[model samples]
Target chain A: MNLIISTLRKDDLYNKKIIENIQKNISNVEIIYTEDMNIKGCIGCNRCWLVTPGICTIKDDYEKLLIKFLQSKQVVFITDLKLGFVSYKLKNIFDRILPLLTMNLRFKNGQMRHYFRYKKHYKMGLIYKGNGNREFLEKWLERVMINLDGTSIGTYNIENEEEILNALINC
Target chain B: MHLLIVSCTPRAKEKSNTDKILDELRKGYEYNGNTTETLYLYKRNEWESIREKFYENDNILFALPLYVECIPGIMAEFLETLKPKQNCNTKIGFLLQSGFAEASQLRCCESYLETLPSLLGCEYNGTLLKGNMFAVSFLGSKMGKQMVEPFYNMGKYYAQNNYFNKEVVNDFAKPEYFSKKEIFLSNVVSPLNKLFMKVFAKKLGCKGSLNDKPYQNYIKR
Candidate 1:
């Protein structure tokens, strides 16, 4: 199975551990680091959805990442929350999903609520590495899941490499 | 009149589609007798300190590239901190360049900016939505290069003869074509990515919330 991991920041310890574990268990998995992305802000032009349909009008590395996402069996986003909110890095990428919202899908609080309903269901994961309360994460994740049409198949908390490793192996 | 144009994108200098379109507009207006100054907002952290200049200008143009469905965080922050003095009289206008073919997102921004002039009691001139300025698939594509031509021509005519002419304003506010099919595709594809991100987070042993989960680097204030 092809695995793709996209992270906005590179210096987070929890993300590093997750990447290390993926490297150990999953071989030849392709990862895209959005922190390295060079993108112009969307010009509020609806060209991607209106003209090209399913394609972004801005020429940047987003297309490359989207291509990888379409072909991969699994996709991941690594982010640090700021006071119960996604990082600016994460938020920017999330916001770019505007084009995707126009498709035939149901979203809750700006996240995909139903994911598994698609013809193919891919494994999903999240690595939260912050001091915020865990309850905040759960509530937010539930909202995202509502839109995704899937549940968290596996989960691990801050600095829990062993539990995540076990979950990955079993899944 | 001394006019100020703020370009919000980080890459306003190189291979920047927004900058190219704004540049065309600026060139078109230069011959109209107004001294225009363009500033790249990302380059200066002290954007707030320049508020005084807005007071001095008669025409103010806010040119932006959309980030997600909203303005950039920095611009939002800037707007929050901007307090126009009582009786400030700068006429406000907007010019937006987007890679998309339709101008739907501009409405959201217009809704936000509409409050700007009202709050400050300034005249709301109008907004120009330039669509299909660049193709995200090939930013430097030939069609992308030609997209800014009309903006340049119109801006020149407006600047020289009619900066606030009714015909020019109407033309600038002209709506571009849009498609429901593309919108559907985007809506569908987006959820797929969000679902993948959630599963990926679970696999990594994330601790915080799924929708707005925290990364390790966000530990500090």
Candidate 2:
């Protein structure tokens, strides 16, 4: 199974086109429109690591989504760039996933980062829609991959439905 | 020059390391006969007024901790509220501090912050990145006092020159990349530290289940 978490607005034309293409090409995929979800930003309380021990203390829609994340073989993010980075809505989702990683630090690629709690390795991709700097996004994604213990298959700038479809199919 | 310092931490002013550093910086700015104000970004109700202050100020500095290799979610949300540049001549700077001992952990977010000035139509005044900053909270202790002096000096230099001294910034962000010797030492010490932490957590009734998958039961698709 694959999970697609999108921060695009309901009426966005690009979102519509991308969703249509994914529906036609992909199977056993779950699409989450993040704006419609009841998710809260992480408060950085350290409860997930210290108190609850790999459980987010905040009760919200994120719990269900996190479970789906672990079960899925692949996860993709479709977001609009804000200041050459992920939008606040998408970043909020990313921040709330700290429980997916253990508090233990390990060295990977010559940098220290938290170890992943899950055994499965998921392929990740970013499909961004904006005129933001691509180099900055690529570097940020590279760091993200290292931390999450995921492989970055591709990062695509929205041009057309075919481009989006190809990226999804390849992933 | 009117300076607006935004301390972006989820914790309250008294408990935040970033706020403590900004406080010292504010002292330097005030010492130079400059007016300064601080806004704690977690005060969500005051965001509108803070935005107005942001527009009214000439120099804006963001002091924040690095979270998950980036700025905190609240900071990102605050950045979203800013309207695109409209004759705004604000000079923007950042003070990014992290708990990680290696300075390299904070470099990726530094690049992201550099791009923010362009998005806001402000001049980039450079960023100050510091690592192993968990000690800033113990300001009364000797180690804490030593850790904070560099920030105080950087703040004073900025107040006098209207920009961070490149030498001071570079010195403060020492060992930009950790050496092999440091890496080896960390690798040797990390496991022992983890073992100690596990024992401590167990004593706190948390047990050694720090790596437990609590959501295993919720995996039904």
Candidate 3:
């Protein structure tokens, strides 16, 4: 299943439209709006690694999202821009996703990386808005996916429906 | 320079690698008669005050661990709250450290940070990139302190000059990426390293396998 997560608040008209448009155009995707959720950022506590084991210690709506991601083969993030990167809410989501990975390290394609806890590959794509660096976002997504033993589906702009289609098909 | 050092690690000051490095940095920075103050961005309730500090300070340095290949999410949240400084002559810099040993892991983030200060209407004070920072957690106390003690000299250099010294930064960024030969060597030693990590995790009270998945049912894709 493909998961399209919008990190923007649901009330922002432009953000809501962007998400609704994706829902209308795309097939077989589940959308998540994080702004209305009671999610907190990961505090770098290694409890998931040493204590809970694949379960984040923090109790929040993100636990459900992590389950969705574990079941998702393709995950595309929709982020409104902030400092040329994804919004804080989206970045917070990314940080909390760490529990799906093991604290143990292994070498893959020469560099060291954390082993995937669930042993599932997750191809990642990005849809970004505002005055952001699209190239940098793509590179960031590509690097992060590679670390998870997955390939990049690349990035797209809201208006670039053609690129988004290509990326989703490719993902 | 009356520097305002912002520690961006989500961990508390006592347990942080950022704290260890910054302590060494402060010792050297203050040695040269430069005064400094600190603020923790993890305290969300104080973000309003933190924003105030950002505006009031002449020189600001962000010391952070390379969490998930970039700045921590909370720090990203704080940075989003900041508006451009307009005419304020605040010079901003980054001190980025990571648990990963390779410098290549940090380059992508470094590239992003190069353009960050200019976007906020501030002068770039250059980034101090370091890796192999898992020591603070995995190593003994003395060994961990020894590993970060080099930041003292780096702090002294930054205090004397306005930006990071290229030599220390380059030394910290050794083996930016591995060559074919280095890869072959690293592959041979990979098993030993893995065993060491397992033992270290065990010592830190990891109850089960490091690869244990309590939520294995979530993988039914």
User: Against the native chain B, what TM-score does each candidate's chain B reach?
Assistant: 0.68, 0.85, 0.90
CA lDDT of each prediction against the hidden true structure: 0.55, 0.80, 0.82
How large is the i-RMS for each model, in angstroms? 15.3, 2.6, 1.8
lDDT of 3: 0.82
Best by TM-score: 3
Worst 10 residues of 2 chain B by lDDT: B134-143
Encode model 3's per-residue lDDT on B1-221: one tens digit a residue.
Answer: 69999998888877788888898988989996889998998676888998999888879999888877678898888898899998878899889998888888998888888899998899888899988887675466889889989888888888988887567687767878678787788778878976886777677777787788777877855
lDDT of 1 by residue, B33-105 (tens): 7678887766656575456566666677877765544355445434445565567667777776554445543
Put the candidates in DockQ order, highest first.
3, 2, 1
* Residues A54-148, model 3: lDDT tens digits: 77889889888888887887888878888888887888888887888887776677787887887777778888778888888878888888777
Ranking by lDDT: 3, 2, 1
True-structure lDDT of candidate 1: 0.55
Off by over 4 Å in 1: A1-171, B46-49, B136-144, B160-175, B178-221
Q: Order the candidates by TM-score, highest first — what do you get?
A: 3, 2, 1
Best by DockQ: 3
- Candidate 2, superposed: residue stretches over 4 Å from native: B135-146, B165-167, B199-208, B216-221
In the predicted model 2, the residue pairs found to clash are: none
Clashes of each: 52, 0, 0
